[model samples]
Target: MFRLAHISDPHLGPLPEATAWQLANKRIFGYVNWRRNRKGVLTTDILDNLITDMQEHAPDHLAVTGDLVNLALPAEIANARRWLTSLGAPEDVSVIPGNHDAYVPNARMKAEEAWRPFMSGDIVHSGSLNFPYLRVRGKIAIIGVNSARATLPLMATGYFRKAQARALSKLLDDCKEEGLFRVVLIHHPPLKHSTHWHKRLIGASRFRKTLRKHGAELVLHGHTHLLTKAATEGPHGPIPVICVPSASQGLGSRSKPPARYNLFEIGGKDGNWQCRLIERGYSTEDKVISELGNQMLSVPNA
Candidate 1:
């Protein structure tokens, strides 16, 4: 079975010294938020320990669904780069940014340049990176869509626009022809009425329409900071949508969930697939990432 691991919203912390210029814009709010709240709950050591423990399982591919840095500070971004390197090589890891990564205008561009290799498509058809990037490893096809973009203050929403939606639909159709297990990775959960309006995915209906038109074996996201299982319609049937909690959050915070990751075990032929999903996470009591849940996903009828 090919194993895929999913993690999100590291929010790597301890604000790096930022110039007044950097904090003059939207970052000022984020910087204040970090100082007043995040710095206390998001312990660097917790994230470090979680990664070390996750590597022990050795998933075939890793998907990081954004929020790698806090306030998009230069030093924070640099630290996240080193952290990604510590996890695995760029090819072995696939990433999509979160709202926090694009906390301010043009900040997403800086992150893209800094993390080009990790978030890039496997094959550059246009000789430049674009979403939805397709990466095929073994029998699995991993598709990444960038949903991170700057929004007005207190708004943390995502959009899978018409152009990207059309492209994603086509890519899913092509992957179906290849008979690979298709997995779409995004940062926002895309769940209707499940999140605060300010934090919802703006183009979720369109995105869901694309899934219904083209179909996929699975959809995974991580913005909710909760271990959640939801489904939306696909041509074949209902497709599984999985979301995990912040990978580095500690136990003291009541607002944030504990650190965790999801493991997807997939194997089988075109007509029938056997898939098992296991949730592994860390707890303050144990301080280790252990199995929290195991589920056998319904196999699609061919």
Candidate 2:
């Protein structure tokens, strides 16, 4: 049995000090919203809760869906790396970049430098290429892609380069032949919705079609900062799409749920494959313990 922990949008930092850029955003009220609607109850309280919860669960691999830092600032990225290192080594974890991480023009370079201490794989250096990167773990292969790209001030959107999209198709095509469990990690959802078109996954349709053609077991992403569930038609069946809640919002209050994480278990079940989502969160009442619940994913054989 393989247990993978999914957590997103931690936005770790030295607080308002490390992320001055985010502080200057016109949407400053968004942070206020986090304080009121999310885990903004105490100082260092949320991070404390997350660490305790993750340690207790001890998942086989930790997959962070991005937004590790609030502003993609050098200091914020450094702080993000520290938090991630505290969680576990890069070998035990896989991370993708989120829009926030790419907010700076040199976001990619900054991230690579800041996270070098924890990365388990070699950085891809092809000109104009930044994704379809692979992280092989046992029989499961994690395809980490950079969906966060620098955009104009008016845009505030994210996009995958055309080259990256094509590379992704080829990557999946090759992985399909290996019969490995393919898990694509991105910060943006492939399906368009409330997010601006410019901000949405630009090549989502082609991306999904490629997944259907090559076959993938799961797609994990986080950027919406809300809990979401969707299934895309795949060659094998409908693939599960899971969007996890944020790790730190502002305050833990009654109006909103406290910070949370997702725990996924993929393994053999009665000669068939099984994958389940375990919603895990910190219990305010318990304070020291992490709460959990199991929910299975149903993927039909095509």
Candidate 3:
């Protein structure tokens, strides 16, 4: 069995001091918001403990959906690189970007430079880093797509362009032919109405259409900071789309759940793949991490 661990939206804390010029644009909003609302909630200690517990499980691979930094400051981006190294080697962990990682124009470029190793594909077609990259791990095909982009102030939107859609379609078909379990990773929830209009993923309809045309075994994302289970249409049937709570969120939040992560045990063969989902994280009643839920997502046909 291949054990894959999923985590997202760490929003790594202790926001570094930023210059006036750095905070002059959309990052100003994120800076203020982090100080007033998120500073106390998303703590490093919480994330550290959670990571410790997750490492104990020793998953075959780790998928970080996005939002590794808070303000996308240069220092924050660098710190995130160190944190990713601590998590594991680039070969063992795959990452995609989130809206917060691209809080300002060209900030995503900085993040990409720092995080290229963790998000890079096995083979580069154009000799440059591009989204919708494919990485094969055992029988699994991990496809990383970039949905996060810098938006106007007060907006936290993501975009899924037609270019990526076309690339993703081809990747899905190729992986299917190879009899690999395709796991598509994006930062934003792709289903319609999954998030607020100001934060929704543009071109979601086209994205869904591509998925319906060329199905994947599973889709993982993290932007809502809520534990969500939803499905979209696929050629074979319904495809499972899952979102885990922020990896840095603390308890006592009125709206959002505490930090959590998921473990998926993928087994079986081409015609009868079996998957088991195990949810683990903190709760309102305790600080210790424990198993919250375990159930079969896909079962072998009789």
Candidate 4:
């Protein structure tokens, strides 16, 4: 079996000191929000404990679904790279950016530069990093999709471009032909009405249409900071779209759940693939990381 661990929205913090110039634009709002609210709930200690426990389980690969830093400042981007290294080697981890990673116009480029290693695919696109990149591991084919982009203040929406949709459709078809279990990683939930209007994934309908037309084994996402389960139409059946709470959210969070991560044990072959989803994280009663639940994801011939 190929074991894959999924985590998201760590929002690594302590708010690296930002100069006045750094906070001149969209980051200023994020800075204020982090200071007033996010600072208390999203703690590094919680994230550290969760990662320690996740590493103990020893997944074959780690899939982080973005929002690694709070403000996407230069220092935060660099610090996130260090954190990624601590989790595992770049080859063992696959990451895609989130809305926060592109909080400002130029921050996305900076994040892409710092996180290139973890976000790159085995096949290069003309020596440039592109979305819908393919990374095959054992029987699993991991596809990284970038739905993140800079938006106006108070807007945390993501966009799924037509170009990415076209590329992803082809990748899904190709991977399906190879009989590989395809797992798509995106930062936003693709289902319509999955999130608030201001924070929705633009072009989610197109994204779902692509999946329905081409099909995939699984879809993993983040950005809600809530443990959620939803699905979209697939060729064989409903594609499992799963999301976990923020990796750094501490207990007693007023608005969101505490830190959590998912482990998916995927096995079997083309006509009879089997996948089991294991949810693990902290509970309100204690800080310990433990298994919360386990169940089989709907596969072609489960």
What value does the lDDT take at residue 287 in candidate 1? Answer: 72
Runs of candidate 4 with Cα error greater than 4 angstroms are none
Question: What's the true lDDT of residue 128 in model 1?
Answer: 44
Candidate 1, 1-302: lDDT as tens digits: 99999999889877788899988888888888888877767788878877876788899999999999888877877788888898999999999889998888877888877888898887855444598899999999999998889999878988889999989988998988999899999998877886899899989999999988888888999888877898988888889998888887888666667898889999996769878998888765767668888989974546
Ranked by lDDT, top first: 4, 3, 1, 2
Model 4 clashing residue pairs (backbone) = none
Give the candidate order by descending TM-score: 4, 3, 1, 2
Q: Per-residue lDDT of 22-135 in model 2, one digit per residue for the tens?
A: 456533543555456432343366756776777787898888888786556666777787778888877888888887777657776788667754433445553443466787
Q: Which ten residues in a row have the lowest lDDT in candidate 3?
A: 293-302
- List the global CA lDDT of all models: 0.86, 0.70, 0.92, 0.92
Q: What is the lDDT of residue 108 in candidate 4?
A: 87
How many collisions per candidate? 0, 9, 0, 0
Choose 2 or 4, whichever is better by lDDT: 4
Model 1 CA deviation exceeding 4 Å by range = 125-128, 284-286
In angstroms, the error of model 3 at 22 is 1.1
Q: Select the stronger candidate by TM-score from 2 and 4.
A: 4
Residue-wise lDDT of candidate 3 within 122-211, one digit each (tens)? 985544578899999999899999998899999989999999999999999999898888899999999988999999999889889999
